[model samples]
Target: MRNNLISGLIFSFFLGMSWLTKADLYDATLAYQNEEFTLAFSKFSRLAQLGNADAMYNLGVMYLYGQGTEQSAANAFAWFSLAKEFGIAEAFQTAQLVLQQSNDQSGLKDFLKLQKSRLSNTYLLDSTLTKLKQHSTTPTLSKTHDVLPEYPDEAVRQGIEGWVWLEFDIDQSGKATNIEVIDSYPRHVFTASLLNAVEKWRYTGSKQAHTLIYHFATHKDEQYRETLAIQKKAYEKQLRQNIDAAERGVAQVQYYIANWLSMKEYNAYQLLRYHWRSDEPMNELYLAAAKNGLDLAQYRLATQLINAGAHQLGVLWLEHAAQTMDIAKYRLATVLLNTGEPQDVPHALQVLIEASNNGHLRATLLLVNTYLTRLSDKAQAKAWLRHGLIIDPEHPELLLLLARLAENQAEAKKLASQALKSASQRNWSSHAIHLFLQKLAN
Candidate 1:
């Protein structure tokens, strides 16, 4: 928990909307004042998702100050802008202040604008709020007694580490029953132990099925070191092969080695085992692959460059990759749109349309948002929404957007209900659909 409240006025600012009960707001504020940053953040997030304008403001402040979560000027601005839309008068000033204090002010503003576009989408906001309200009433199942599997001696001797994914149901008396091993790495090595342990497990009975993954990792003792030695030998052998392939101008292998070099494991193991390479050459590996015309490598390198603030160069690489990659087109469109330059808007829309035509969901959604919010072309937005629905009729986002744009109340409710039915597939949210439907019924 970080004690970066900025001022006492933040507490008073939490009173903006009536969606949250006074007691809930008080508890969240009290948690923050007591330096229980994580708890405060969780509570405020739940409240904010449920359309509590004040909670949105509090989340913005917390994000700006890195109170319970990572400090993010972009997130702070987004939440503040959302709160402003909900009638929090101070949110605009707070958003501007966050932008002013940001290290990369120009880039921060673009990212913040992107966030605002997302948060301000009425279809998205309603879905989020409705889902939160619904989830609030759902009963949470918890383990009453926990059990861990004892690692098999044979597994230890073989120096094998694996995981088992188990699916089971809880009986009325809170005991585990009907246990089935869904999948396991290294086959049946750990299955018997896992089954035996899970048989004794207890939970607060919900009669609902649940899935759990139990990982068996050997401790970093003598056995683990032996396993590591074996793995390192194999890794070195493969590394030599990959290096040979990379040197022969195999673009895919070059990218693979570059990706491996970028991993934390490579850094940790390189100091211990690989004395042949350093950080700088590994960093250039992606550049080499990109130069060799690996589209994926080009996209990856472009992302790195953009994040590092080399926007012009990144956009150029993105354009090259976008000629063949739908995802790259979407990324290029995002960057172009974020620039907020008049000349960039048409190019952004063009690429987004190209990506959307290829059935890229995110690109389609962005296109709809751009047409609706930026271009103020409701007919184009609706047309794209319809196109998106054709791609994935059950997609909750597209359905929700259609629901919000429906010409009549009955049509709106039907679309919304359809969105709610398919929401579980998207893991979008819960509970709000019921509340929203109830509101519609009344």
Candidate 2:
């Protein structure tokens, strides 16, 4: 009778512990939903290390956002893969996204192998043993897994999988302008899929065209094999040749610094500063240029000084530059914001408004947020939010904030529901939705 009583007490204690864990997880989820990512990250990471698959998935998301830790796609992949091994569907999707962003396939393969091995050992007492074994046997090849789509002929193998490297030119609009395979392994079968996948890739827009390289690999059988090695080699050669040709096309921009140093041309000082590295020599050059009364050079020197945290000295140069250059005004505004002095806010706001009007998205977002949330000016905030919606309707923060601003409860609920749906699609935190569902059920 005493043994039975002791056993009952032990069971009750365990049950209570289980409930506490679940409650912690629920709280973490709520924090994540509210974008209190730091708290969410700490809670999720603790639970994850304790072997909670759901918590592992959430922790991976926090890493992706740089919440409690630095943003690391590799760490995110490792945690997501760990959760994926436990058969978490969300983790599986997140693992795939992390893999897509990763440039290192070998690292991912190592991580996946480690996770599988760990799971195999753990699952001896778990019901997921069979599923884990099945995952081990399946080939890592599918439409969703293949992010880059280009390969070399030699690396294309009809029945094998290996890595392929390719270089492509991305235009200012973020579209692939030209693609050429640099190298591949198991060359025959890999090239076709690589090319097909790469053609669909989109990049964030930049001011100038940029060159990028991607490495990808997959497993497939002979039916999809396509030989493109010779073609790839020839294309790479042509790309190099084009680069060499372009060097000859711009004589003024090329070696402009060398010419400026010899001629001591103050006008060429501004142009030279553009390509200068952040070193002592560059600093000396900038000082000389600033002394020569070049406003652009003064602005560049001020930026360097600000970055080095010599705020007082930087401000002196910036004030001089601001007399003639709009860029100097923008830089001064940024410095003021970072310093957080009450006296600087008005000037910062003025310069930020100018920059926003000139179509700087960063300045625009900052300005809008300041008006809406910080300053508490609802009318101005609403106007800014409406303008931002027109510019970027799909921005998550804006959508969520708008939902919160709805006049009636029904309207608020409807907008929140829609925003939550969109957030789910982006795999953003879903704690709020879960809570809302719980409330409805109760």
Task: Tell me the TM-score of each prediction against the true structure.
Answer: 0.47, 0.33
lDDT of 1 at 357: 94
Instruction: Name the best candidate (by TM-score).
Output: 1
In candidate 1 the C-alpha lDDT for residue 65 amounts to: 79
For candidate 1, lDDT tens digit of each residue in 1-442? 1123334445556544332122245567789989999999997886564345667788888987799999887888788877787667877877766666668877876876676665443323233222322332323468788787888887776556566766555645466543556456568999999888877777775453355657676653356556666676664666677666665456566555555554443323354226326444444555545544457666765655565555665676687679888778887998888888889999999999998999877788889989988998889999999999888778776777787778888998998889888865534453556666787789
Pairs with steric clashes in candidate 1: 130-432, 131-432, 134-431, 134-432
Query: How does residue 240 of candidate 2 score in lDDT?
Result: 50
* TM-score for candidate 1: 0.47
Predicted structure 1: lDDT: 0.67
lDDT of 1 at 441: 88
lDDT of 2 by residue, 216-279 (tens): 3322323233443434455445435533432332211121232233232222333334434443
Which ranges of candidate 1 are over 4 A from the true structure?
1-234, 266-278, 430-442
